[model samples]
Target: AQSVAQPEDQVNVAEGNPLTVKCTYSVSGNPYLFWYVQYPNRGLQFLLKYITGDNLVKGSYGFEAEFNKSQTSFHLKKPSALVSDSALYFCAAVDNYGQNFVFGPGTRLSVLP
Candidate 1:
């Protein structure tokens, strides 16, 4: 079985400050990791993904994540956060086998002015 975890239930950041949301995973082999953001009453929106090549993967909304094989972690990061960035973030993983897609509980990000 493959699983993902977002240790923080919520993350608070000041507008224009750098922000990060932690994520760790467990899987049999190399896993395909993903990050998604959900706004109020909206479906999850794709943020970024790590499949094979590069360790650092960049995605929409000025978001990026680094795939750390040693730590089994893929934490989402942004150089500067905005109040509009406030939303629920989720980390997900699919094993190399591609049999299952598991999602983290989700971490709420609040960017204050």
Candidate 2:
């Protein structure tokens, strides 16, 4: 009853521009949301989380997300993208009781100079 889906496998953007990674979730109860980034064999780095209030949450590396209750979506966003920002982005959600954690396959972001 809890899961997430990222329709796109990759996103291409220009450096110094904005970038976004899409994510949507479904759960039976209130969810704890998180975003993580992994850079080629590196440990997953936490980006942000949405536990309760405030639909918009900011996180590490100039990244942020908007939690939309009506749409059941939490999308990652950044104003200015960097070539170094290119990496694998993952969206995850946990049940209130911590029973399960589901992750999207991943989105590979590429920023061109």
**Of the candidates shown, which would achieve the greatest lDDT relative to the real structure?**
1
Provide the lDDT at 108 for model 2.
Answer: 95
* lDDT of each residue in 1-113, candidate 2, tens digit only: 67899878999999999998999999768889999999998999999999999999999999999999889999999999999998999999988888789998889999999
Provide the overall lDDT of each model, using Cα atoms, as 2-decimal numbers. 0.96, 0.93
Model 1 backbone overlap count: 0
Worst 10 residues of 1 by lDDT: 1-10
Locate the minimum summed-lDDT window of 10 residues in model 2: 1-10
Q: TM-score of each candidate?
A: 0.98, 0.96
lDDT of 1 at 17: 99
With candidate 2 superimposed using the best TM-score fit, by how many Å does residue 58's alpha carbon deviate from the native?
0.4
